[model samples]
Target: MQIITASQALMPEGWQSDVEIRIAADGRIAEVGPMTTRAAHHLDMLLPAPLNLHSHAFQRAIAGLTEARGPDPADTFWTWRQQMYRFLDRLDADQVEAITAMVFMEMLEAGYGAVAEFHYLHHAAQGQPHDDPAEMSARIIAAAQIAGIGLTLLPVLYQWGGCDRRVLAGGQRRFGTDPDSFARLHAGATRHLRDHGHADDRLGVAPHSLRAVDAEGLDAALALCPESPVHMHLAEQVAEVEEVMAHHGARPVTWLLDTHDVDARWCLIHCTQMTPQETARLAATGAVAGLCPITESNLGDGIFDGVRYLGANGRAGIGSDSNVHIALFDELRTLEYSQRLRDRSRAALATPTAPTGRRLFEMALAGGAQAGGRDAGRIEAGAWADLLGIATDNAWLCDRHGDAALDTAIFGGHGQACISDVWSAGRHVVQEGRHIHRDAIRARFRAAMTALEATV
Candidate 1:
């Protein structure tokens, strides 16, 4: 049992002062209330860190490597994917593990207590299954364990090359698997999680995308995990939307909702090209729009219809997709700023009463916990003790308090520097604005990158 006191803490209702939190032996929050007295482990401010609803862990390795323009006049998301495939072609399990650990550490330090890893890089460099079918997934699980971050392991099912159901092509072979093969892979990943005593770790099914999975394949994969959270890359690009429309005679989001029983259990990443009707319809389904603003901007993907979606009472969360930048505040700030730029207005994500920062932070916390299938995102009883202690000393947050503190943190404070400490399920994974294993993880990642660079 452990007790923590904070001068101020963000609760579900609102900010509370002189807050006390009791962490249970099993890492769940047992109780919370006013402190009995001035506790020693006192913090200036505390907030429940949000979960990252979508991430491609291995992509962290190639962050700044894909910025160069090629011979194509129109550099696009499709071209970026080609670069990604080329980069991953040489990645092995150990390198993947190192890079993933580094990413998870960064996530924790950046005020994300948990991550939903959309893992899809299966098989070997030449697209052959390793001796242990779950070898690569084991690497991810191991990395997450070492980093001490809550993980929702999403085993992806990728089969076809596109909406046309073309056979897996070069640079895409490693991610291909038939329904039966994918089922086995998913089951194997689950067993590994259980055997490692991470029984509470979620196992979700990802059908990759509408373009990658046919209706039959999607149905089969969803059937394999009925209750687990389902995530997919939705209308992220204009080309993808057009392709799905050409093949299915409906927009990607339209075809998906009409075909599947999507609900609160589903999270659609990057609805950047959704029509207004599609946005409203998707919002009505209680599914989360897993927005990765930094990545969308990096790839020049169009902005999501935030005003319209929020007007329809949509659920949404932030993700560190592509991991070019991993700061949670940056993701939220980028999301709000994107809408602001589009509408030519200030505070585009603001509600009537709540400020933009508080509103975005609260919505992402709730929606992200729902999407990740984690018992977190709140400093309340029964939630995991995934808390972040915000440093009051940050020059940008000097005179702020309550919601204003959140505003400064999100909009003005330096990335991760505003976060003083972080607890992941009661483990003090980050302190003094650094992960406990930051140096080791960074060193391993540096070595891995060095070796990879020599090859590439």
Candidate 2:
């Protein structure tokens, strides 16, 4: 068991002072009460660490490599995707594990205690399955174990290149799998996790997108994991929406809601292209809108309609999609700023009871837990001990208390520096603003990048 005492802590009931928390051997919070004089790890301010609802861990390796403009007049997500595919063709399982470890460590340092990896890269370089069909997924699981980050492994079903059911070519070949093959792969991954993963690890299924999976394929994927979390990329780009419309005769979200039972267990990634009616309809379905603000902006994808969506009590969480930048506070700030920029207003997501920063933080906590299907997002007994320690003495947080501290940490643009410690499921993996295994992880990632650079 581990014990921690915080001068201030955010509990589900609200902020508490002089709180002491005990983490059981099983990684759940054992107890919470007023602090005693017993020896315990001390924290200046403690907050619940949220799960990153969506991520493609390998994409972290191609972060800055796609910034250059192609021959097209306007660089868009499609152009960036081509570069990403070219990069992944050179990646092997060892390189993928190293890159994923680095990304998971960075996420820990950035205050994300867990992640839902939207994994789709399944086959070998030449579109052939490895002897172990779940080889790539096992690499991801190994990386997560090394980093001590709670993982929600989402094995994606990518059956087609587009809505027209074209064959996957080039880098897309690595992600191709029919429903029958995907079922075996999913079972293998589940067995891998059961044999090797930590207690907090989970298995989920993702239907890559409407363009990649047809009605029958989606149904098969859904049947594979009926009660687990179901995630899908929905209406991320205008081109994608148009393609779905042309093929399905309705917009992506509209058609999805009409066809399936999308409820609280569903997490739809990037509703950036939704109409007001679609937004309201999706919100009413109790599905989480997984927003990746930094990646959305970097790809030239339009801003999500946060004001209208949240006003309808929609659930939302943030993710470092492309991982071009992996800062939790920056993701939240970018989300709120995007809404303000779109409407020419201030504190666009603030409410009557909570301020902007507090409101965003709370909503992210709830939505992230719900989307990842993890029993975390609160500093309460029986919850996973996913917590962040912030230093009140830092320049960005000095002399701040209550919601003001969160506001300054987020809006002051130096929030990452204030993170002094992080615990994911009672594993203290990050300390003093750095991941505990930073040096080793960095060295491995550097070697992988050096080898990848020669080929790409």
Candidate 3:
């Protein structure tokens, strides 16, 4: 049993002072209240931890390496993708585990209690299925298991390389799968995570993107995971929107809403380039829009019209899509900054009643839980006890209170002060702002990168 006392903490509806929180043996939140009662153990500040709604763990290594322009005339998402493909030339199971472990460990330290890895790198180096089809995915799951972070293992299904259903390009081959092969891979990943995700862990599915999946392929993959959260890349780029319009009659988001029976179970990653009509329609579906601000900014994907979307009461959450920098603060900061730049206005993340910082944090928490298919994201009984603690004594946060603390964090505070401690499903994965597995995971990562360099 564990008990934590916080000078101030965000409970379900609002912030409470001198709060007492209790955790039972099973990792579910046992109780939450004033610090009148005591337990076997107690600690300081606490808040529900943030969930990372999207990630491609292995892509963490390729972050800075892909910034250079390729031989292409115009460098864009496509050009950068080529660099990414070239980088993936020699990632076997061991390398995948090492990189993913380090990535998850970093996320834990950064106040993200859980991660929904939109993982699709499934095949071997030559685009062929390994003796075990889900060999790579199993490695990803293993990394999360060893790192002790809450995971929503989303095994992605990729059938085609582009809108034309062309054969997968060299790097694309690593993520391709037919329906039967995908079913086997999906099953294997689920089995790998079944026991691991009871009170603390989770699992889900991602159909890489509309461009990478055909109608038949999408249907089959969704059928296999009837109840798990299903995510997909909807409209991240202008070229992708154009491709979807050219191939399907309408835009990608419009087509998905019109064609399928999508609801809260779905998360549409990036709806960056949605039309006005497409935006309202998606809001009506009750699906969460999975946004990745830092990665989108890095890739120059156009900013999402968050102000319009929020006005429609559409749900949305932020993710570290490319794992470029795995801080929950960066995702929130970039999301707001992108909106501010797009509209040239201040407090764009604000709702009508609440302050901007509180609103953005609450939405990401709520929507991320939906995206991850978990019962979490707030300080409440019965919800998974995933919490993050921000320092009250930080230079930027000093003399601040409530929403001001969060606002200062986005617009003033450094990343380190904002991330003090993190808890995942009632377990303290990060203590006093450090991930317990950091050093060991990072050592393995360095060794793996060295090995890959030799292979290259």
Q: What is the lDDT of candidate 1?
A: 0.90
Please give the range of 10 consecutive residues that has the lowest summed lDDT in model 1.
Answer: 194-203
Under the 3 Å rule for N, CA and C atoms, how many clashes does model 1 have? Answer: 0
Comparing 2 and 3 by TM-score, which wins?
2
Error of 1 at 47 (Å): 0.4
Full-model lDDT for every candidate: 0.90, 0.94, 0.83
User: In model 3, how large is the Cα lDDT of residue 221?
Assistant: 86
Per-residue lDDT of 1-456 in model 2, one digit per residue for the tens? Answer: 899998889899989989999999999999999998644589889999999999999999888878778999888889999888888789999999999999999999999999999999898897989999999999999999989999999999999999999999999999999999999999999999999998999999999999999999999999998899999999999999999999999999999999998999999999999999999999999999999999999998999999999999999998998889999999999999999999999999999999999999998899999999999999999999999999988667885888999999999998889999999999999988889999999999999999999986
Best by TM-score: 2
Q: Given candidate 2, what's the lDDT at residue 170?
A: 95
lDDT of 1 by residue, 364-453 (tens): 999999999988999999989989998787577895789888888889847468788898888889988888899999999999999999
Residue 158 alpha-carbon offset, candidate 1, angstroms: 0.3
Q: Cα RMSD (Å) per model?
A: 1.0, 0.8, 1.7
Q: lDDT of model 2 at residue 319?
A: 91
Q: Rank the candidates by TM-score, best first.
A: 2, 1, 3
For each candidate, give its TM-score against the true structure: 0.98, 0.99, 0.96
Which residue pairs collide, candidate 2? none
